[model samples]
Target: MAKLTTRGLRIDSGGTGGGPVTIAAEDVAGALGMGRLKPQAVLVGRATFCDDNRAQLELAKWVQQELHRRCRRNGWKTDYCEGLAQLCVFELVHPLRCVHCLGRGQLWLQVPERRGERIVLVERWRTCPRCKGSGRKRLTVRDRAAVAQIGKSQFADVWAERADAMLSDLYGLQDDVLRHLWKQFADEAA
Candidate 1:
């Protein structure tokens, strides 16, 4: 079971010592209240610490149903709908770190600066070009196509759009869970 507190959100991790895991309120507030999507809050959104994983399961089921409906409407075979939905949910829940920036979403570049007739290199951070500051790697076309059981051309032409929609819905589900956690924290504080 998980408990929301003014200090933090506590979950029984069932570790070797049987101690509960506590996530700071500040972290929760930053991730949920400010929509920063910090790692701890993301884990919470995955329902990892909860006794029942109904929220995530329900959202995944919704994604699968929506994808099936869209595939039928588009006259595409729905045989791979479950796999496609699973892929989308996995992307939403466990996004890979951007390799380019090493998940920092920024790069430290040495810039030449002139100070008192001397040239010195100063380190400055810039947003990562590869991930566009998102810090997450995108699913490749080949992988997505394989998951959808479609050719790359067809996936690129039409299936990708449907996949993106399902991904968006998964994001919405995460946001909704975060919002609910935020409300619970607020209520606890009151």
Candidate 2:
């Protein structure tokens, strides 16, 4: 008797005087339903952004458009205004919890045991290794582009603050664009 095994399927007999049998790649893939292996990607702000924040980002986009319109109307010269708006919006949104741990800061492990002819599964929770029990992680990035863009926004804010103060001291009022922009930011913060 000859035995052949593929993915735990055992063949105990070969009717022909066969040394080996070859299987086509397509046949195996079709049998395993490999065509359905890939999933459609979901569009979102950050790779690590949670579903709960999706609606918040949408609302922030509306605010960003409003700010952009106001800035344009005021003839303000701001580089990366669109990117800054998005980064500011994301910053305002609450920090996302660790996707690996699902905000639980812990992981549930399944242990299987054989009991007679049946398998019993048990689950236990332990601190998540990825989050280190903090339950949060910074957003995932494809590269340093996101970090650089965020840095630009921080510098813009600082420069705007100084320019606002200087303009106010010289003219008895702050720059209208900066005042309006910060007001919108404060509203979003609240």
Candidate 3:
């Protein structure tokens, strides 16, 4: 098992073999050949990267569980569940979202008629500043509200329902295929 701590979070990343086992640092890319490594290491807000071995992942799980238990014992009602959902979904599925245009792909380059100078064929499209070229504004068209509900957990049921369809179509993976792979894969690095 591998163990590490960063920003006060502990990670225990080893486990039974054939499943995901958090390997040493140099082992992660090599481990890619063995199998996919799920990002089992949970993290706090905006935290990225973690120890990916059995010991480190285990400790991470333990810390989070303890925090939740303590919160529950004292009736703090921490929103860990929602946070976790957001973390997992964003971590797992963000790349898929990147493929989408987010309603903004390009804009026509401003062309000027100088009447004599050779007509410079400007590049056809320029990136949108609003969406940062991701084409998706943080605001929804209907609600005109910021896109705080993007991650997951906070998603409305209707959105989730639509998202399932989108996921099925966009990923080109059937629900069963994802479940099968997810059940088997434990070493997704990216």
Candidate 4:
């Protein structure tokens, strides 16, 4: 298997055959390699992006495991830890985008309109009820506390700070991975 690494971008030929093959810059060398592919940069960029996304997901799982460990050490129940950890992972991976309007802050509703001799359905835009025009999901303090498996006051005082730090680290990792992928592509293009 070919292994390639540039900065933090790694592409190893060790995935299932059905999945995308992450080809690195080194793998593009020689006649029988990816050099034969026209617009090699675009294909390589896509593969690199996919690999980075997979890496981010793995990092999110690590964050969940760390959160679960903290919960156990803090005497939280084991049964709740798994679900709460998963929730934290979801929040870490997905941005605070509204699911209802898909972050558009508006929805198109079909309403009945009377037009002379017939009733017609007209599409009208309305502010999203879930996000209330904010275009972002409302993750309340109560909900955060629930995920932390602690009282609201305790969560605000202690767990909130810790969780925020963890989330920041995860975001930083994602940013770094993207930067690395971009750098790799730039190097390849040169």
Best by lDDT: 1
Residue 106 error, candidate 3, Å: 3.0
lDDT of 3 by residue, 1-190 (tens): 1112333222232233343323344433333333332333222211222323543335335444554665577675455533333323333233222224444445667755454766655556777555455443332322311122343444443234433332233223222222333333344542
lDDT of each: 0.66, 0.41, 0.36, 0.53
TM for every model, in the order presented, reads 0.58, 0.27, 0.26, 0.42
**Model 2 stretches with alpha carbons more than 4 Å out:** 1-51, 95-154, 157-190
Look at candidate 4 and tell me the lDDT of residue 128.
88
Clashes per prediction?
0, 0, 27, 0
- What ranges in model 1 sit over 4 Å off? 1-44, 47-57, 71-80, 110-122, 179-190
* Candidate 2 global Cα RMSD: 22.6
lDDT of 4 by residue, 3-120 (tens): 2346333432223222223444443332112232333222233333434465444544555677778777878544444434544555654448798998777899998899999999
**Residue lDDT tens for model 1, 53-156:** 66456656767887889888989888778777767866766678899998777899998999998999999998899999768798798987876667889888
Candidate 1, residue 114: CA error in Å?
Answer: 11
lDDT of 2 by residue, 63-158 (tens): 456456656776765554555455434533344678899867779988787889999998878788998875756554421136325454554554
What TM-score would candidate 3 get against the native? 0.26
- TM-score: which candidate is best? 1
